[model samples]
Target: MGNAIELYDWNVYAIFAPFFAAQFFNLKHPVSALLATYAVFAVAFVMRPIGGFLFGWLADRHGRRMSMLLSVGLASAGSLLIGLAPTYSSVGLTASVVLVLARLIQGLAYGGEIASSHTYIAEVAPAPRRGLWSSIICISSMSALLVATLLGATLSTVLAKQQMVGWGWRVPFVVGGVLGIVALVLRRTLSETNAYEQARTERQTGSRPSMMRGIWQNRIAGLRVIGLVVGGTVFFYTWLVAAPAYAITVKHIPAPEALWSGVIATSVMIVVLPFAGALSDRIGRRPNFVFFTLAAAALSFPLNRLIQNKAWQLTLAMTIAGVTIALVVSILPAVLAELFPTHVRAAGIGVPYSLAVALCGGTAPLLQTWLATSGRGDLFIGYSVVLLLIGTVVVLAMPETKAKPLE
Candidate 1:
């Protein structure tokens, strides 16, 4: 729940950005305002690597429980700040600055949450069932995403256009703030896992180096994490995060219909994630990633071609993309956590994973929008296919760890 709530805080901004972009930005045109908003969104993502390092070290050295507690508190505070922030009409440029600051805080919290939660979940699940258990991470994430989409659909349906742009845009941030507190309260009940306990014991015995040194030592594994993440993250943000906005703004779909299409596609993701994870358990981690990358590459062109101005077209494109996404993300936490020893698991995964996502996933939406506006949407599809193929190569090169015990 805590994990889910933080992600909601992270993503709710994207769903509502089109409504609020003009509020904070002083751009002349709506398109310019939207672009500026996404630039700020990208700026927040750039902070993820720094946050990942800070919190990942804390988790590795302190405890995952404590790191998580701190992260959620920060996330809630950020959400509240955004909810209460003044608009440009009242505060001028300060409003935009406030939004940036708040986004930075949430980015840090999100980076921390990813590191700690993935390590925690991977450590606690029984070895044989780790793949299946890891599905909970993305399940929680996608569930949060689904709620934000539904909320968007609901607000778009019931609220007048003026109402949405005026005050309705801020409602989700406030709701996320409240949810964060609830998640914090719930997370308090969680205990440290046996793996972390064991790792902590070893640390006291002087079995580990400084966090920086440890991360450096495992840099090769870190690079692999980047390679594995870059392609998948691009594919993910393109179809899932940016689809609705692209359809509404570019393809000229109705706002409510665009949002509803996201609701449907994300619902499909939530359902398939667990089954994909279980499949990885039955076969191997490599096969799921291999298949996902190859399938994503193979389908990118045709699926993109299917998208049109209609909501159904957008829904169909995204639904297909969602299924392919599940095959990689459902077992991704397990794969990432397994790459390093417990001593540096959180930091090792955090630094590189966040870096990859910040670079590739963060820019994906803006890049796609720019290309589409330039009459080069097909080029972006080709770009995605190339990235997925690269990811496939990386997956094939990496060792299969399905049956290996976590160090």
Candidate 2:
């Protein structure tokens, strides 16, 4: 439930990009409006690093349970604000401001939520099956995305184009806000991780956990997080955001078809995620990371070309890519958590992971659309390959942490 609430707003925005793009931006061309909307999306990410630091600090110093509760509430507030914001037609530039502010708040909440939640799970799950248990994070995220896409498909199928553009876009945000409430209620039952409690007691008695000291001590782990995250986040947002946006806008597929394609692809990925997590538990995280990077780097461009040729090809490409990426995403919680000890686990993971995601992940949709618009879409393919290659190197150098004891 906590994971679902953390990601609900993100998937909501990605799925409804087109409808809300028009509502938020009063541009002449649809593409220009989309770029504007994506620009706001990217801009909101600038706050992620700050959010990571603030929330990571809270988890590290106070408790993971409290941090999760606060982040979810903030996320719900942000979604509600976006749902209630005036359209450009109603309030002109003020509408854009409201939209941007709402996104910023969501970005902040998600940064903290991801780090804290992953840390919490890592500490609670059994040592031998940490990978499988931690994979629940990705499963939750994929489920949220699936729900968002299905909702979009349903709404687009039912509403006329004009009706969809008018008000249908707001429904998902309102729904996400409600889901957040459910997650909040569920999270109230969470207990503090024993690892964190032990660390906190130790700190209060004699030694205190310092964020700076933790980073300096685990600086190499921090760098590894950034390196691995670049490819992971870029590829993720590419498949998750750019592909569907391109299909609907550039390919001129009906909105319902495009949205349904997304639903099918993401649902397949969701099923694949836990299996990948279990596989990581069996074989180790490094091999899975290496396989995903090498395969994605080699196949992504060709698969992208195939997607441009046919709708079925689009579904196939997204599904394959989504599943492949799930291998990495599923194990990421365990891998990142294993890199740092409990004293700095949340902050160490949060800062580097959030920074990489903010810098690479958040801007992907805008960058891909702009590159495609400029008739250099192929560059995006090369961009993914380059990032993957870097990730391959990082994975190759990093030590395996499967079932490693949490510090």
Candidate 3:
């Protein structure tokens, strides 16, 4: 439930970027307006590392349950604020400011939410089957995207264009806000992890656990996280956010068709994620990461080019990318949790994960749009390949953590 709510909160941004662009940005051209809005989306990510460290410290020192509760509340408020915010016509620049502010709060909440939720779930899972259970976090997030895209597609289908542009876009944000509250209520009943409790009880005499120091001391592990996340984040946003937008904006595909394609692709991922996780449990984490990174490097360009002219091709390409990406995302939480001691697991995961995601994931959509518009789409493909190559090198160097005991 916490995963569901957190992901819904995060995904609402991508699913509604077009509507927000129309409402908040006052540019003359539609493309310009969208770029500006997506720029705001990237800007919000600047807050994520700070949020990660802050809530990570709270979780490390106090409890994961408390951090989860607080993060959800923050996200809920941000969603509600965005839903209730006035349009540019009514409030002018203030509306855009409000939008940026709302996104910042949401970024902060989601940054923390990811770490706490990942740590909590990984700690509770059985040692041998941890990959299967940990994959649920990413699956829940993908499912949220599926739900949001389906709803957006349905709304576009039913509402007239003017009606959708005018008021229909607010519905999902409002609904997400309510769902966040429900998640908060559900999270309150969550029990503290025995791992954390045991770690606390067995603390070495005079050995203080410092979040910042822990991350710095675990610098090698932290860098591994950054490597994994950089390519993963870009792939995720490209498939989930940029692809749909590119189809609608560049290919001139109808909005409903583009969104429905995303819905279908995301639904496929929802099924594929668990299988990938289980496969990692059997084969090992390093092999899957290496395979996924190499596959992404090899396939990204041709497959991306394959989708350019038609909606069906776009759907097929995204679905393929989704399946490949699922292999990495499904096992990532367990792998990350296994990298650090229980005393600093959340902080360890949160710091580098948030940093890489903020730097890479958040900027992906804006970067893709800019590159495409500048007629250097080939360069963007090269850029993606380079990142994947870096990830492949790192994964090859890092030791496999399959069925490893969480210290």
lDDT of 1 by residue, 56-106 (tens): 999998899999999998998898899999999999999999999999999
Regions of candidate 1 where Cα sits further than 4 Å from its true position? none
- Local distance difference test scores for all models: 0.90, 0.88, 0.87
Residue 316, candidate 2: C-alpha displacement in angstroms: 0.6
The regions of model 3 sitting more than 4 angstroms off are 204-206
The alpha-carbon deviation from the true structure for residue 85 of candidate 1, after best TM-score superposition, in angstroms, is 1.2
lDDT of 1: 0.90
RMSD of 3: 1.1
lDDT per residue (tens digit) for residues 247-365 in model 3:
77766888888898999899999899999999989999988898899999899898878876677988898999999999999988899999988888998898899999999888888
Error of 1 at 159 (Å): 0.7
Worst 10 residues of 2 by lDDT: 304-313
In model 1, what is the error at residue 143, expressed in angstroms?
0.5
In candidate 1, how many clashes are counted?
0
